[model samples]
Target: MSDQPPYTWWPAGLRRAGAALGVLGVQWYNAARTNIGATATSTVFEPFVTTALAGAAYARPFVRFAGTGTWTLGRAHFAVGDRSAELLAGASPPGEGTYGYTVTRYTNEAHKGNGLYRDLTLELVEVTNAAG
Candidate 1:
C-alpha cells in the first residue's frame, strides 16, 4: 500500500465540521431568542413578561438573527429553564437600578463593531407580587 500519510485531509474536514456545528448552535440560539429572567430571590423565571412588553411576542419561533442587549441590576440573564443562556442578556446579581437600559436588535453584524452585540438596553419596570 502507498504511504501517503493516511488521510492528510482529515484535519481540514474535521475543522469544517466543527465550524458548521458552531454555526448551527449559534443559529439555534438566535432563533430561540426567548429572553427570560427574574430576581435572585424569586424561584420563578419569567420570559413571557419581556416578550409581551418588548414586542417580541410576534417574533415567536424566533429566527436565527444576531442581536445584543444590555442588562441592569434588577434584571437577570436570559435563561432556558434553569440554564442561563449566553445568547441572551445576563444580570448583575442585585443592586441599584440604572436608567435608560435597553436592548436593540440587529440584522447585520456590521451595524455594531461587536457584530454579535448591538447597542441595546433593558429595564424592569413592572414587578408583580409573588403568589402567596
Candidate 2:
C-alpha cells in the first residue's frame, strides 16, 4: 500500500558493531542553573537540563583519542582543556551532585570526509555557586 520500499535487516554485522561502539561512548549533559524563586531575603537556584541553546551548550559524546594536548586524528587537530570533564575520557556520569562550569572557550574542527561530525574542544573552569 505504500510507495516506499519495505525495510529489511540488511548489513546486520555493521548494525551490531555500531551498537557496540555506542555502548562505549560517554554521556554529556547540558548544564544549567536557574533561579526558581527569588525574594528580597533569599533566592533558590535549581538545576536545569535542556537541549535548547541560549548561546552554546556542550552536550554530546565524542570518541577521545588523546590526552590533554593537541593531537591530530585523520585530518582534525585539537586540544583538550586541562579542566575538561572526566566523562570525556569515558568515565561514569556524575552522581547525585550537581556541578557548574564556566565555558572559557569552545572550538570545533570539522572533518573533511564527514560534515555530520565535528571534533569539539572545550576549555572549562569549574565554578561553585553558594546561592544554589
Candidate 3:
C-alpha cells in the first residue's frame, strides 16, 4: 500500500477545477505598490476564478487566487480579467474597465501538517479610474 496520506489527491483535484472554471487572470506582484504607477520588482501572471461575495452586490466583484501551491503577494492589478495580457516588470497595469479590480483583502488556507498552502483567496473591489 502507498504511504502517502489520503489527502494527497486534494491539490490535484482543486487544480483541475481551477483550470476548467478559471476564466480570469490577474497580475500578481511580490511587493506592494505605494500607488498605481509604482514599479514592481517582480511579477507573475496567474490565472484565477472569480465569484461574487456572499450577500454583496454585483458591483463588488470578488476573485479567488487558488493554486495547488503557496504564493506570496503584496498587491495585484486586475484589469479586464484578460488571461492574454502580457505582464512585465515596470509595465503599467491595464487601463480601467468593466472588470478592473484591486485587491482589498485576502485569506490563506495552509496545511498545518505540511505548512504548504493549498488556496489563496483575494477579495477584490472594482476600480473606477486609472488612479487606482
Cα lDDT of all candidates, in order? 0.24, 0.32, 0.34
What TM-score, to 2 decimals, does candidate 2 have?
A: 0.28
Q: What is the TM-score of each candidate against the true structure?
A: 0.16, 0.28, 0.24
Counting clashing residue pairs in each candidate, in order, gives 8, 0, 0
Let me know the TM-score candidate 3 reaches against the reference structure.
0.24
Runs of candidate 2 with Cα error greater than 4 angstroms are: 1-96, 112-116, 130-132
Give the range where candidate 1 is weakest over 10 consecutive residues by summed lDDT. 1-10
Question: Which should have the higher lDDT, number 1 or number 2?
Answer: 2
**Runs in model 3 lying further than 4 Å from the true structure:** 1-99, 111-117, 130-132
After superposition, candidate 1 runs with Cα above 4 Å error:
1-77, 80-111, 114-118, 129-132
Error of 2 at 71 (Å): 27
Could you tell which candidate, 2 or 3, scores higher by lDDT?
3
Instruction: State the lDDT of candidate 3 residue by residue for 1-132, as single tens digits.
Output: 122111100112233343322223222222232112211211123423332222322121123343344433333444344322243323444552356788998878774466633545567687778764
Q: Write the per-residue lDDT of candidate 2 for residues 76-99, one digit (tens) a residue.
A: 111222212342343333322557
* Better structure of 1 and 3 per TM-score: 3
Q: Per-residue lDDT for 104 in model 1? A: 43
Residues 1-132 of candidate 1: C-alpha lDDT, one tens digit per residue: 111111100112222222221111110112245543211211122222122222122112111122233222222233222222321243332222534323344343342446654433332343334342
lDDT of 2 at 50: 19
